[model samples]
Target: MSNQKTSDILISEVGPRDRLQSVSTTMPTAHKKQWIRDLAAAGLREIEVGSFVSHKLLPQMADTGEIVAFARTLPGVFVTALAPNLHGAQDAFQAGVQKITIPVSVSEPHSLANVNKTHAQMFEQVRQIIACRNAHYPAVLVEAGLSTVFGCTIQGVVEEDDVLRMAHTMAELGVDEVGLADTVGYATPLQVHRLFTRLKHDLGELAGSAHFHNTRGQGLANVLTALDAGVTTFDASLGGIGGCPYAPGASGNIVTEDLVYLLESMGLRTGVSIEKLLVARETLKQGLPNEPLYGFIPDAGVGKNFHYAGEKA
Candidate 1:
């Protein structure tokens, strides 16, 4: 079964959308465009360019449409965005995002705080969004993300049944896939293994990507669990720049650099060049000057004995 699973890993870059939304200062559109371009040049096939939230609240994502337009020009790169509702989905479709991800928290308190909607209400929103996408953008993939699947900062201890139901609900609503997210970064490896295994049992082909946070230092461990359960796609941020700003210290996603290094050393093909990924981190630091980046691989540097694919040892 492991051999039958995907031999190549798909790293879906989320820095432009997630990282910028977290920082105290807003990144300029030109910088964000260059960041996106540099990441694509580093061989990231899929990227979550931006979110379609209110500019009044998230000024950083105000240029989501423009970023999406710019990302589309890069051949072989699939542009993705986060849309909370039908309106966002419409905007995403107009901007030509190839995929749209909508997050619905399992914890009611988290859900209300994040989107001001209940899980049920959010499910309806996803359904409506899916309908609209099917009518106008049939090729566009709709990803329903179940946030706070393990625990929540606001409510705490989300039930596994809620996650299963959310996955089933989204799949029933015509979503292309359903993802599990560690929004507050409280997932353990055991929990990761259990949830994803159970979720796959319930959701089948609808089991989507893994969106883990490095809040409590268990980000990569959670990814390992997901891999053991047959997950091939992952969401990561360059330099680990983006995470739940509300949850301090939980400031990075699983670093794209580190995850790639882990996968590469373990014999999985990620199709990313570590040198290019590291070079792109410079653009990240430049974009968010005051933001402190996190990643062990970047600090430690690649070992002398390390050999990436297509590179001689």
Candidate 2:
């Protein structure tokens, strides 16, 4: 089979959106641009460049359009953005983002609080957005990411059946894929394995990309569980610069450096350089002067004896 015919892991770097949103100090736009360029140059094929939410709402993402345009200049990279509503989607589409992921919370309380819409209203909105994107920007792929699929801080446990129903609903509404997010970082390896297995059986090809956060220190464990359950695509932040604004000291999403190192050590191909990934952390410091970044790889220093398997670019 051709390489194109084979399925491989698609790691969508979400540090710009997920990680940046929680921090108070807005990152420098130039530093953001250079960090994105460096990541793309280092071989990440897809990156979530920004979110189309209001500048008033998320000051960290005020330069979304500009960053999206800059990301487009790089070759062989799929530039993506998060569109919180139809207006955001339109802005992202105009910015030439090839893909837009619109988040819809599985937990109704989270949905109402985060986006000011109920689950039914959000699903209907996704339907309209899908129609709009299909008619106007046919090249763009819309993924309805069901956030808090595992558990919610405000809403307690989200039922697995509810998640599958949302996935099916999004698929029926014509979304390209349905992504599961472990918002608030409450997912464990057992839950990840069982939930992914259940979603695979129910959602089929539409189920993908386990989004994990290291809030409770189960990030890499959940990642491994998802891999065992046959999930390939993953959403991780660079430098582990993520946390819930409401939940303090919850800094970290499965660090891209650690994930790459784990994959390489297991003889899997991630196509990312561990050293370059660590070097990229310098941009984190520059972009976020006061922000404290977290990750074991940077703290542990990749062990004394280690070598990256990916071909250096």
Candidate 3:
């Protein structure tokens, strides 16, 4: 179940890919490299470095291959990238990403609008991508992410049964892991707990990271519920800088700095150094000055008396 060997809670940094893709301003490649290095040095063991999609569609991800290459050189870092379809998965494989996440929306309309493929078509693409990985890069892991599992902006109130069915199908298809994503920030803590609990029961070791948005300010609450449901891995942005491009009204992922603060304060070990994380986030700010960066911990600073879990006071 572990992707890396260091932490009790694995905070997978998604700012480079997820945040950069959503924003209009593109971060320079060298800044991205430094930011990722700083993140790794700060004790983040896993990072979603970039996406392997068409540059025409998302020019922000144009340098993903380079970013993946750079991220691979950092010791102890597991580099991941998002691949929308079989073609993008192949590109990711060729680029040598340690893991590839392919998002499939349980909401049919969302699936179509996001990737221009229906859920059934996406299923086929996943099969093809897995086959390609098996034939060429067996060591690389493919994760099936159930985006919009809670609800969809395009078509609201996504069915829970449909999500379970798709997760079951993904497990059957041999994906390394299956995860739920609150793509449009439509999840409540109760819904997150219930759905994640069900996903764990259905997928067992395959139920993976929780990707939540703070659009409605329910992201941390959902994380608490997911942890109660036995999920450890989480996807977060450095400065709370991302949202789904196709899912309207989806604003940003939960801020990584704030999430780490909460986790460490609760005695759950995340291994990220809050001080260094803030420094790394400054790199992000410098890279994309026009884009807004959000985090509670950064503004308020760590408590003078607070110490991370296991640190001697």
Q: How many steric clashes between backbone atoms does each model show? A: 0, 0, 0
Give the alpha carbon lDDT tens digit for every residue of 58-84 in model 1.
898999999999999987788899998
Provide the global lDDT of candidate 2 against the true structure.
0.82
TM-score (all chains, Cα) for each model = 0.95, 0.93, 0.98
| Cα lDDT for residue 13, candidate 1 | 85
Q: Rank the candidates by TM-score, best first.
A: 3, 1, 2
Better of 1 and 3 by TM-score: 3
lDDT of 3 at 3: 56
Per-prediction RMSD in angstroms? Answer: 2.7, 2.8, 1.0
Global lDDT of each candidate:
0.85, 0.82, 0.91
lDDT of 1: 0.85
How would you encode candidate 2's per-residue C-alpha lDDT over 90-118 as one tens digit per residue?
89999999989998888898888888898
Best by TM-score: 3
Writing each residue's lDDT as its tens digit, candidate 3 over 31-130 gives: 8899999999989989999999889989999999999999999998999999989889988999999999999889999999999998779989999999
The residue pairs that clash in candidate 3, if any, are none
Lowest summed-lDDT stretch of 10 residues in model 3? 1-10
Least well predicted 10-residue stretch by lDDT in candidate 1 = 1-10
